[model samples]
Target: MASSSVAGEPKQSRPGFFKRSVQFFKDAWGELKRVRWPNRKELTSYTMVVMGTCIFIILLIFGFDLGISYVLELIGLR
Candidate 1:
């Protein structure tokens, strides 16, 4: 009678936060397994594009820095 509810029997133990988190990771792994990963050639090409863009931006910033420095030096600010 104490374990029984007004409607029926005892309520089963629901999964706690940690157990739910583990289940979520398991489900995520299953989904990740179905993914079509990029090939090495595509990865290398994308990497090279990123590298080239970074190099170009760096050179541009350095050129601007040098120009500003020269102007400041001319004005005896340096």
Candidate 2:
């Protein structure tokens, strides 16, 4: 069950497993070369933004937890 080339050349009869691994890596590496990687300043800014957002969410969750605990304690729910 092998494929033939357009010129009637019998395709390489390699095993049916992972047919295009090398091709996939080559294509991926090519794409990686095309990427415009972020500069240090941009990376720092992005990281800071992400950190600030995480801190805000954590603070919000902490406040909610404290409020719920206080209410539960007042009702003798431990």
C-alpha TM-score for every candidate: 0.68, 0.71
lDDT of 1 by residue, 1-78 (tens): 455555665677889999999999999999999999889999999999999999999999999999999999999999
Per-model C-alpha lDDT, please?
A: 0.94, 0.90
Q: Per-residue CA lDDT of candidate 2, range 1-78, in tens?
A: 554566666667775557578778889999999999999999999999999999999999999999999999999998
| RMSD, every candidate, angstroms | 6.2, 5.7
Which residue pairs show backbone clashes in model 1?
Answer: none
Best by TM-score: 2
